[model samples]
Target: MTAHIPQSRFAPAEVVTRPQPGTAPTDRRPLWTVIALTAALTGLIMAGYVLTIGTWTVWAVVAMALITLTTLTLSLGAATAVVGLIFPAPRAPRPMPDWQPSSRTAILLTLCGEPPRGPAAMLAELAADLQRAGLDRFVDIFVISDTRDDKAKAEAEALAPLIGSGAITYRRRQENVGRKPGNISDWLDRWGGDYDFMLPLDADSRMSARRIRHLIHRMERSPSTGLLQSGMRLLPAETRFGQLQRSAQRIMGPTFLQGFSAWTGDAGNYWGHNALIRVRAFRDAVPLPKLSGVAPFGGDVLSHDFVEAAWMRRAGWRIEIDADTRASAEDGPQTLAEYHKRDRRWCQGNLQHLRLIAAPGLHPLSRLHMAVGVMGYLSAPLWLATLLLLATGAVPMAAGWMLLAVATLLAAPKLCGVARLMRQARGLRTKGVVLRAAALETVLSSILAPIVMVNHVVDVAQVFAGRDCGWKRPGGASLRLPTGGLEALAGTGIIALVAATNPSAVVWVLPVALPLVFAPLFIRFMEAPCACLMARA
Candidate 1:
């Protein structure tokens, strides 16, 4: 017998009612402490710049401000890591041997134009996993497609076996209205009320049945919690670039995430996937509104997860992250070009948050969340400008001590991350391996940093110029000569100018300059496979 599905409203809310979750006092001391530390460090760097130069010209002042702003961002990260190290890690939830879900849940796998073989296989495995755990009856799998006719036909074919056995249902939308978020909304409008919860998974997202059960159990216990985000680790990678990223995430990601969770508390942000969402709460609170303008800033929100999280918080439901959930994972970009391509879309989406920072009724922390998102991308341009200002002799080179201080501040988080890993190591051999991997990851990441900075600067500039980074799949390992050439030119110019004008500054500029000059080679290197780096450790 076909069960009748209750439809839910899809209209955007004109006004938010008072939050049903009462305003319990959240301890924000850690947040304030981090803010104060960032400000103090920024001030110290600015003061050192003034003392070193012995004069404050207009250019010097502007450069100082930009440098300090970038320094502040870096310091905030270091401070968060320090805080993370201070706080003991959150304990993972205990397993419930006799637990059974009292409410229905759905697993939503949102698809675009990607090939379906992998995701179909993943879903099949997931279904099998759930059956093994004896929880398949309480959950349903939905393959939501936003692909064109060609891709949709392929997806239907690939998913045919699963559908035929009633293990999964496939649905394709005629219009890709709001992109991924729109696809989810369409699902909610049709069958949202029939399910108590929904676990949204991206095309690349993977979670085990045990992890899914853990998240559901957490949600079932916390009635006021609207969104429960799992800690996502990177899947093992084949390319050096992917390996570096995975290793870094494996090593350093935990402390940062722990600090972030401590600071945000119940008003945490969301990453749009691998999260358990209370269907009724999401339906009531997160019907995304179309912004009044056009692409980029206007129309549908590109970075909808954070905004939906903000809206969910405004409507008075707890949004939390359980960093201890280690079973959830996702694939990462395998090459520098692919990384930048994905980053460009994120850069555009984050920039869109600028318009909504001061939207009515948002919690202060939610507003801060949006501001943080905007600043994360904008920091790239600020950093690029600082480097350019130094190269042009607009600002005098920083004093040796000042430079050392800045480097230490930037490297502090990595040091803390490494330290934590070493402490957790059981044997001398394991610690030695951890140290070697850390050293290699550091060197490679330092070389890659400037390239990323330049890419981000271009992304920010293009976004402001109304260039829309449309929803497109990340391209394969193809060299972009234009991007590489631009980097090479910028690096060569910076080095030549600095060496000719201020010979002493050449050393300081080498880190940024050399990478830019050799960007094409570095890109190629990153695209090649290397298993010896941190990922192997």
Candidate 2:
């Protein structure tokens, strides 16, 4: 007989009681199926590309092989995600029928120079919702500030008036030691023992009381769950980049989340914010140990959420993302420049995961998760290497069939997402919008790919060189050309080389080269206030 997942303990004097347990959830088939499919597809593409590398230098052949393999690794993930959409798994625990919270929860809101009014307003809204649901007594809010600036600190202080006697509290650390992870650890060390569950939210994160209650209910029903991450819907976007980013997310997020849930199951990862965690489990199992090196890859674990989840899983607790829920929301960056700026820090943090991928007691899938994070940045340099080899005729002309295979591997998952959305639509109206959005996004992504690749390549290099990608709070500055002079000259230089070497290759390489050549102009146009307004219109 299968062992039952542990049931949670409830405190006495609760108004509501428990419900009948529904299902035990013991399926790993979908995860293995996705892995098998990815491997098969990657192998097929690698074989096709290897067969086509005739007449090239051995080094060039090796370079092509490496590129093909790396690219396929990413492709395999996409394919797995598509498979997830097709065979979606239930991410939340079995429905708790008439479940009610049996423990107090603390909503830990982390602040780092964010506009205070925004969060204060969000808190008011959340408080009102909880009071209406009769859960104000069960849940309390904590604003943990890590702001170093005086003005920002004062701004955070202004939020104190919004807090009542005990339901809401505010505290700020004078020195932000390890950025966000450190800030969180500081709070956990001091006040974590007082609460049974802790729900961490970013400054921009928002969720309804009902949704929050549902999450707590799910957690209380499953004692083994260490984390319950909600998939947040992006709030309204006032700028062009934000509009496109959120639109793309709406179209593709579900399918991707479904696949992710399928593979990760109870061993899922965290996305930092908008997630509920068991206080005791987190405080006990996931104490982040400082690595023994310098900046970027060593010092503080920049990407601590993944590692924390790994540790929790190692200690026999479940970490899950409930994508089926839709009440949680957060803001996306309004411009491409802001997005890339955030990604710069993310790049460093993800690269830092290389140090912990081999940490003892971590599960195999958890190791794969960290390895994938490392590849996310490394793939850019590999792509650039492949392009340089092909552009300089160091490699023989890539066969049409091989290129087609590569395209299929890269594009098929996106097409599948679009197809899935269209099929699920209730009317022609949504279908039309989705089709337009998908096509537009596809074109935009192609245009932006090379520029982002170059950016990541630079970031990864800097990271390895021990560059400090410190804390940067978003929404502080307006968009300007993040990539301009040097990038433009480099793009032109590459274009010139391609033209002089092989004019026939110009068309194939032009799209990748143009964004670099006109980096400032592209950034300016894409981020101009008018363009964003027009996109919204």
Candidate 3:
């Protein structure tokens, strides 16, 4: 039953304890149709704007260019997603009739500055679940730390006795090296020889042992899948902003991910955690090549998971998500300040993907993934440009109609998702709940959007100026009124200009401006723990 790959520097002790599983085959022809449709929709909208405007002034040209780019990016999330919802893909990999894995799987908990008690306690509970399923023998837990904090390191070392003997092991690096990717790569170099699969989980991540077994079984049925990602839900939160995001995610996240899965098929992307990876495939194919030069776009890649998936696929492997499984959950940043901190780091990391978009020998889909990552952050600046032009009367008034069309396109995916969810639930009760949640989410998000936009603009500017954000844990603290107002100043200035130039424009501009004007109050209200608890009750 045990199949072993040839031992090399890539995996000195690699062993396949199980027979190679069957490859999960899929037809991807429909994906292209969806892509073409998305392109056509974006082009038609752009053409409508330019033709209606009937002028090509320098400012108009810049605004139109921004509009075109932002629309194309938005279309991927909206119009094409709506198409995928309308015609969903075959369901994700499920348990095979009589197949079981013969391989040992390592559950890696990568930590950096986090206290050990949290992950250790989670694993201890998981140990009991695995024991109940009689799968204890096939799994082991590893707490890999890159914590520079002495107290955190000490706390992690002290938890060894609590986790018991061989069921768990603790290891740390003297030098943090390439951040998270380095910590994981180091483990593979040292301990990867013993296991056929690795499930990398973030410190905040949790998944039941039954689900873990199911994931392994699914992988056993999917020989070609280099990595299998799971849908992660947000944990129950105790803050208004947290609750808002959680509600939005509950309503829309599955549909969004399913649509992505439909288009991606075998070329699915990898999130950093809540995923399983085949040892040999990852070891050989994803060696974590260092980018040339220094920080930002160069040196050690900030977003290693996406690039790793691309590298594995380049070496002939498939990546997929187990959409049917959704028990995995993690805590999110509770406050807007914390969210901004997290996003700033992500913005820099995503922007760095520009360097890899055209890397030689990449699959076209892989290239598209990189380009999408780059645009996720780059589009913010483009959006900012469009707003500035519109507010200053530099663009045509017909731009208002184009904006209306864009808003419709943006809402299409959510509308489709709710419709699909209603159908799947097969009852009016679920539909009512979804609608109520959607309305509340829309209101909360409208306020949050301007704050996020301004933060991303600053983050992108800093990254472009060669400023290294580096990695830091998010401190989930509510901002005082002063700090919050400072963040809102740019939006305040824009609103003032809009009010002075054209009173009629205030209605369209209020959505963005009102959020910024009252951002401090919004943050304070949403950050109130008591209010959050009352709302939950």
Candidate 4:
């Protein structure tokens, strides 16, 4: 059944309308502080390099410029985390104990070709939670399926009981026109008007009933909030690689999110799933525009969440993130291959944001969000290039202190996060476990970083070559070797070149080089379950 959801009209204009005087003020001070700090750190590092080198060759100048840019990027993250440590977003007030939602919310579970059994179980649990909380009457569940194969039939069969009982409304589209965004848009066009708000969920997404009620209550109280994104924790992981990721997320994610929330304020981002959207605001503001070209940079906006958040913000609706709300969770890829496969898709989508970065009438922060999305992938190539330049001795290596400084900046965020976790650790025994896990994650992540960088560099190249990494279900987490052939080759080539010419520099490069060289072995090691670490995690 369709309801008359009034369409809101918003066009990208040449000039952005300034926020009204009384509208919730965005605190620009933290953002400005991050920018200033990043600039200062970059300048200092560059100056130190020049002073140590005491030379001005053409290659040296180019290397210095690249280092400056890389340093700025690295320092921006560290500075933001430090700022978050100093100025945490105030805790959201707890929902009233007896509060009842006044508005209806539809939870849209968008499924692709993923296994349906897991999602069915999750939905069943969600239903039970909501029912226990007396929220079943206020919320409806919809299974919007984009699965097109025999799996579609299987999915329907799996969810048949839920559908038969009227617990979930199921619809499968024959044509996956716009992919996930299209599936959501289809729902919005049809049933959006009947609900006050919609919660878009990924196949792996899970939210506690308390969190859902909290989000709904917040949305009801704040009339202008078009979207509210909750802080998400990674669900318990089974594989060693997944465990490492989960531990890092558990320890570091909160601090980074707090910093992110502080700086973004009302102009926050949407991570697609596990977020609440005002039905009318999204319907009116977030009409996905098919860009005027081909794959990657054109066609359907692949990374629609950020763009949606941006559009909603531009249309004068507040886009907020409640970092204090931490009950929402999602599953992550369990193996390196699985992780890289997902990253490849994300890489293309984020690269597509390059075209939207300059879209007119966007808030500067919105533009920054898009720019950051673009950089998230592009930074890998930049980092690879910077490493190559430094290793070849094209850039003077006299600045040992410069290397030390860069290392410090790179490690600062993790160190800060660990420190915060330790401070909050209740007992000495608990603190020790946190410290050990933090150290293990740090070391393993260092080994994995180069491999991931090479993969991302390849992903960026494919996008530029007009190759689309089409939406495919991630492979299962089965252990295999030779996962990093390209990484192995790259590392071998670098080491060979260095050993043949500048054998002395090989020692300095071993930390990064060894990881790439032994990537397959490392991948296997990472894939193997470590009971010690998993128990602590």
RMSD of each: 4.3, 6.5, 4.8, 5.3
Candidate 2: where is the Cα deviation over 4 Å? 1-25, 89-99, 164-167, 399-403, 472-483, 530-537
Candidate 4 residue lDDT tens string, 110-225: 99889999999999899889999989988888888888767877888898888766778888887887889888888887777678789999999999999999899988877788
Q: If both were scored by TM-score, which would come out higher, candidate 2 or candidate 4? A: 4
Q: List the residue pairs that clash in candidate 2.
A: 84-259
Tens-place lDDT digits, model 3, residues 1-537: 111112221223343354333345676655776688678889888878767875668888888788888888888788556655766557545565544567778889888877667777887887778777777778877777777756554655566664445556667777887789888988888788878889999888999877888889877766777898888888877788788777777767777777777778788888899898998889868777788888877888888889999998888788887765367888888887688778878887887888887787887888888888888878877887787687667775644676687777767777876777777875777677767767777777767877878777778888898878787422222223375675567768878887887666767777777888887788898776635332542
lDDT of 1 by residue, 6-35 (tens): 222223323433335645465677687777
* Residues 455-478, model 2: lDDT tens digits: 787777777766676754223212
Candidate 1: list runs displaced more than 4 Å: 1-19, 23-29, 397-402, 472-483, 533-535
| Candidate 4: stretches off by over 4 Å | 1-22, 472-481
Q: How many backbone clashes does candidate 3 have?
A: 1
On the 0 to 100 scale, the lDDT of residue 90 in model 2 is 56
List the candidates' TM-scores in order: 0.92, 0.89, 0.90, 0.92
Weakest lDDT window of 10 consecutive positions for candidate 1: 1-10
User: Scored by CA lDDT, what does every candidate get?
Assistant: 0.81, 0.74, 0.75, 0.81
